[model samples]
Target: MDSPKGPTEWAEGRHGVGPWEGPWPDDPRFDPTLLAEGDRRNVVDAYRYWSLEAIRAELDTRRHPFHVAIENFENDMNIGTVVRTANAFLAEAVHIVGRRRWNRRGAMVTDRYQHIIHHDTVGDLVAWARGRGLAVVAIDNTPGSVPLETATLPERCVLVFGQEGPGITGDTAAAASMTCSIAQFGSTRSINAGVAAGIAMHAWIRQHGDLSRAW
Candidate 1:
């Protein structure tokens, strides 16, 4: 644990980490010692070299109330990336319905910054949504759904999504209070799941999140 003592000293290190007084890496690429030293992932400057547990602990203290849920019936690889996006937005928790394990590579180690909940099915996620007193809003373009911009998003709500090919299942769609879609002029019927998740989260932020309080 090398403490650089002052911001001036800390800023000198790579990634604004520290003067990292400990042993250095021996590799040739930007010094093998630096690479071997600690967690060098591309996180914010505040989280450089910190252990995964340490980063998670810090994030927990400031996590927001909004929750994110994604349907994982087909074991979509996008689920992990969506979770990572939720982590970036500091969503209270990510609910995974229909499956437990998701691909981790796309997450870029951001799963450590997030809390995940596993639900047996869409009904389970709906129950959890009820327990939290959150409005369950699904993201999909379908009849009777409103434009997300016009919809008044609740401060505490669950934004649920589905797989790439099928969108959301009928059961989940039935359970949701509303399903909103991104206004797209492109030829594609829908956007990528991960991109859709990000867009949905930002929409929530615009409506409920205080930009001044965000990182």
Candidate 2:
């Protein structure tokens, strides 16, 4: 990407570049509006002026096999943050269980580039994964759960997260092929669902994803 913005962008406290200084590239991926005006979206430099569809199409080619699921019975605010994290890690899709609507404020607009699917119940999510031959890994610090730090995650799996406060339901844990818990030494009994999801996704990345492919 061309470092087109510098002092002026900083002075205005705006993000991205402002218009094309020279002849616009003859690429179909670039958005006409973005090229004529500017791109202020929360996107990478490589995709600065690209249309939303173009960026999404490009991302679809490289998304990882692993999926992410969140229990949204309580309309958790952390769901958006989890979506943002999943977008960053390039997960195959995000499955929302128990609810169709969720808060989008925490996602910072990244949801437009991420795939989201809704399940009516936890059992539906598990059955869907099983039908596709994908392992379901529940993430919570419940009893007898294996520590995520030492466990080897499957290359193709779904990492399910429960809502904050209540954590994973017993049914959700029971449906999972395995339950992995994060280690914590602090006084808090559990961590935020968003933070936990990020850790778990990174664990999957460390296990099977190629670091060199990341930006």
Candidate 3:
């Protein structure tokens, strides 16, 4: 095995293995091209030089039961960030409602490892969730919304988020089994959609995720 490279070197895109320093390991997960040319992709050390498919397969074995859904009514820029955060939390999958295409820049290619499904409308997403016996939990700040800090998130549920400014549509909210709001101390009326998604996912992790499995 080659010596581990420094973070600065990797950031500069000048790090990673440069051909096999010794007899190559027999692991089939390692990509020959990445091993020879150096893998500069943004990935954990456990997955260094591993093929994309291999990494995704490993993630699938431990992904949480919770799913994430975002509304893409107007090319919402925050959708990608939500997907990226879902990957970080190892969400079961991501559902996009309203639009098929979303900005991928924020996802930083993590979407390749995350399973994504599209729904033509909120009703379709609700139907899919019901069919799977998964509850729909909406994250939004509105009248009668329970504070997330005090709420009990469903272990197997789809967290639904709305567009950047409009928030959860009435139709979407009607479908949710419960609506949760992150408690805020500041004067801001609401947090960014991406940030809210991360908080909501973390809330789920705190309640039900296997902490021993986290790296």
Cα lDDT computed for each candidate against the true fold: 0.80, 0.92, 0.91
- Model 1 TM-score is 0.82
Worst 10 residues of 2 by lDDT: 5-14
Tens digits of per-residue lDDT, candidate 2, 1-32, equal 64455533233434677897899899999999
Better of 1 and 3 by lDDT: 3
**Can you write out model 1's per-residue Cα lDDT over 1-215, one digit (the tens) per residue?**
87654433224344444345666634222333333554445577656555566678778888878898888888988987888889878899999899787898888767877898999899989998898799898999888888876887778889999899899999889988888978888798988989999999989888777689675
Best by lDDT: 2
lDDT of 2 at 92: 96
Candidate 1: residue 112 Cα off by (Å): 1.4
lDDT of 3 by residue, 11-48 (tens): 45544545557777889999998888777777777898
Tell me the spans in candidate 3 whose CA falls farther than 4 Å from its real position: 1-10, 13-17
Of the pair 1 and 3, which is ahead by TM-score? 3
Quick one: best TM-score, which candidate?
2
Over the full model, what C-alpha lDDT does candidate 3 score relative to the true structure? Answer: 0.91
